[model samples]
Target: MNVSEYLLKRLKEWGLHRVYGYPGDGIGGIDLALQKAVDRGDLEYVQVRHEEMAAFMASAHAKFTGQPGLCIATSGPGAIHLLNGLYDAKMDHVGVVAIMGQQASTCIGANYQQEVDLQSLCKDLANDYVVTVSNPYQIRHAIDRAVRIARDKHVPTVVIIPNDVQIKPFKEAPNAHGFTHTGIGETTFAHVTDVAGLHEAARILNEGERVAILAGAGALNATEALLTVAETLGAGIAKALLGKAAVPDHYPFVTGSMGLLGTKPSWDMMKECDTLLMVGSAFPYSEFLPDPGKAKGVQIDIEPANMSLRYPMDVCLQGDSASVLKALLPLLKPKSNRKWRKKIENNVASWWQLLESRAMQEATPLNPQRVFWELSPRLPDNAIITADSGSVANWYARDLKFRAGMKGSLSGGLASLGAGTPYAISAKMAYPERTVIACMGDGAMQMNGINEMITISKYWKNWSNPRLIVLVLNNEDLNQVTWEERAQSGAGKTEVTQSIPDFPFAKYAELLGLRGIFVNTPDRLGAAWDEALNADRPVILEAKTDPNVPPLPPHITLAQAKAFMTSLIDEPERASTMVNSARQVLASFLPRRRD
Candidate 1:
């Protein structure tokens, strides 16, 4: 067996069934080996249009499944393209591994064509480790160590194999890394800090009347425990977007995502609470949280550095969210104050009304929010959603509600735009039995969705019931960027850089032989979604939408107001900008509760 064969064998032992990547001359040998592995029904090499998509898909796969998502790229440009997605995985704290092909070993240091010092270029991007296989015998151990580090540290890892080394014989290579291994390796990595600190945390919780819980992806597995703790403390729960699945939104005291993309009740929940408990989520937007001295904090996380840095903590507990909660529950005193919880419940209920009103409003072209309203009810209970970064993500986070079993994600920390198609494809590959949807803005769809849609067409029939849908908001603008520019500098400039031409995305999907539906009117939205949802093959639904809608921040600052006023003054088209901005803001609001 050559090094390529041994690498595949090691990956199979690591339980990787599908790897995302693009083919290239430099990595020809590895591709040949992958094709053979697929023919024998052992593994699959899902081809991608760009190397960046490979990284994004791998990152999303790791996020959805606990295992590391894998990708491969050829030398130079291909390896360089993987950096952004790799950084996305690093910032989001997901396990991802990228195997990069390098120039021939003999030509590596001679500046041979397409030769890049890949190890050094990738050193800063890799969250944990980066290694270049210098010999044939090192392949097995390198793969084993990369996989282990990815899972153990929850960070991105990279392994480079020279083109020459990939073809070397591996029959005598020692599998020393797996020498002591047993059956299937599903190692659980837990950082349990202190079991005794639960008392201190419980004491802090008991002392505060108005308590709130801020949850992130760390709380994914500890949902029941977190909810139980919330109920005991009569607390309201607000999730970081990464932790959108931490608790079901249907729970009365649970508010949706927190940050600029969050709901009003969530912002209010953070402000009104006298005490805050942060579990698993290190939400970066500390300004959106309660003032440091205003709320006494009790944070629970496996990582000690993140314990109480965001908010002042009365007690910082370091343990797994579930284990810590279980330990603390027995020592905790149950609070009966329902006032704070009731207020939170009321806000959540009203936010829905506000959301539905905006989502259902009719316009000449469709209102983009209405598309989500149409799509939400049609989603399967177990569907997995992947949203791209843009205004479409705003619609998804605000309008679309996920059920208990549903899962979804996007480029969370890095906020990369071209992730919609790649992420959706990965989700479908990971959970072929479940429905998968990629909701994206036209800018993002045009970025890489067009390329990935073709890739999906080529392999849609490979899996059992590959129920995937791509929903494009054809608004012809980088709507979120436009809104941000307006909020920052002023609105009247016309956002020259933000404007983009609309493409016939549905037609592109149809040309690739996937089912396609184009909807421009609000009346056709429900039917279009129904058609897409019922299709057996991959489908794309492109909706022509109003680009004038603004994605408003949950809380407006004085600076934002000042910028808006200045924009109106500069007024290239003051009347038009003011009217449109007002309409957008008004559409987003609901009647406030009377005190």
Candidate 2:
């Protein structure tokens, strides 16, 4: 077998069956071997339209499956295009191994075509491990170390193989001092909880009258434990954007998402809570957290570096979230006074009501908030949801309520655009029987989602359930950044830069032989969602939404309010913008009705 074939065999032994990538002559040998692996039913190669999308798919695959995702790319430009998505994986702390082809070793130093200093380019992207294979004997160690480091450290790793080296005869390292030998064996890290640390954390939580909990992606696996601890302490849980699915939003004391796009209930809970228990989340916003001296903090995280990084903690319990919480549970005392819990539930109830009121308000065509609101109740069980970075994320964070068994994620730390479609596609590929939905804005759709629709068309026929839905908010504007400029910089929306070309997203899907559903009115949103959910094939559900609707923050600062008024001085769309913003603000004060 050739070196490329041996690499595939090694990956199969490592339990990785899928590789997301595109083809090129630089990596022709690996492509041929991939076909052999496919024919033998040893692997499945997902060919994405762009190499970047391939990397995004790999990242998403890891997030959903908890396995080391694999992506292969040809040299130079192909390697460069994978950076954005690889960085996404790196920042989010997912296991991904990127195999990049390089020019032949003989021609690499001679500056042959597609010959770039890949090691230098990938130094930061895969900081934990990056190696270029020069000899066929090194393939074993290269693949072994890359996958091991990626999976164990939760970081992206890179393995570069020269084009000529890929076709070389496979060789195992000799049992000699000069050559290094490696074996395929997975290392499992034990979760060891410190007894003193757990006792201190429990004491702080037990002593507090009003306790608040912040959950992030790290707490996803510890949902039941998190819920139990919150119940014991009478704490309200606030999820970071990355931890939206860490706890079911249907819980009474669960305050939706926290940050600029957070709900008011979360903001209020953070402000009032006297003690804080942060679990496996490094939520960046300090303003959204309680005042420094007001709350005694306790944090649980596996990484020592992440402990006390966001907020100063009195007790830092370093271990797996579930393990630490389980150990600490026995030492904690359950609170009898339920008044604090009652207030939190009330806040959450009123917040949901306000969101519905805002979503139901009239707009020129349709409100973007209403689109997500309409789908919240219609979401299928165990559905996987993805959102692209833009104004769409605002609605995604607040409007949708995730239940148990549902998996949802986006580009968290990277927060890059063009990830929604690829993430959803990856989710469906990994769990073909589960439903998947991708929410995106016009800007993100134009950026990469459109090209990936062809990808969906290519693979949808093979899915067991065939229920992927790509929902686009056709607002004709880069609404998020435009609003950011207005709210943060006190500048009016720059029409030339913010205004995007209008496209018939639904019609485009129809042309691709996929189902298309269009909604331009609030009344039709629920029906359109129903049709999309029950469609025969994959679907593109497009909503002709208004760009003027404001994505208000939980707590609007005095400066932000002044900045909005200042931007209105010369804002071209001031009339409609002001009207919509006023309506959203007024919705918060609307009377709450008992459901």
The candidate maximizing lDDT is: 2
Q: Mark the 10 consecutive residues where model 1 has the least summed lDDT.
A: 175-184
Best by TM-score: 2
Candidate 2's error at 327, in angstroms?
A: 0.8
Residue 484, candidate 2: C-alpha displacement in angstroms: 0.4
Candidate 1, superposed: residue stretches over 4 Å from native? 171-191, 362-364, 491-495, 570-576, 587-595
lDDT of each: 0.84, 0.93
Residue-wise lDDT of candidate 1 within 1-595, one digit each (tens)? 8999888988998888789999887787798899899898889788889999999999999989978999999999999999988998998888898999999999878978999999899988783789998787677778888988887678999999998899988855445763432233666656564655667777778998999899998888899999999999999999898888778778988888899988888899898888899999889888889987998788988777777777778788876788888878887788876888888898888888777776655554778888997887777888898899988888888777778888988888899999888999998888888889999888998888898888899888976886799999897778887767667877655657777886988888889888888999888889899888889899988999877665667788999988878767665545655665666667665432334
What global local distance difference test value does model 1 have? Answer: 0.84
Model 2: residues with Cα > 4 Å off, grouped in runs: 591-595
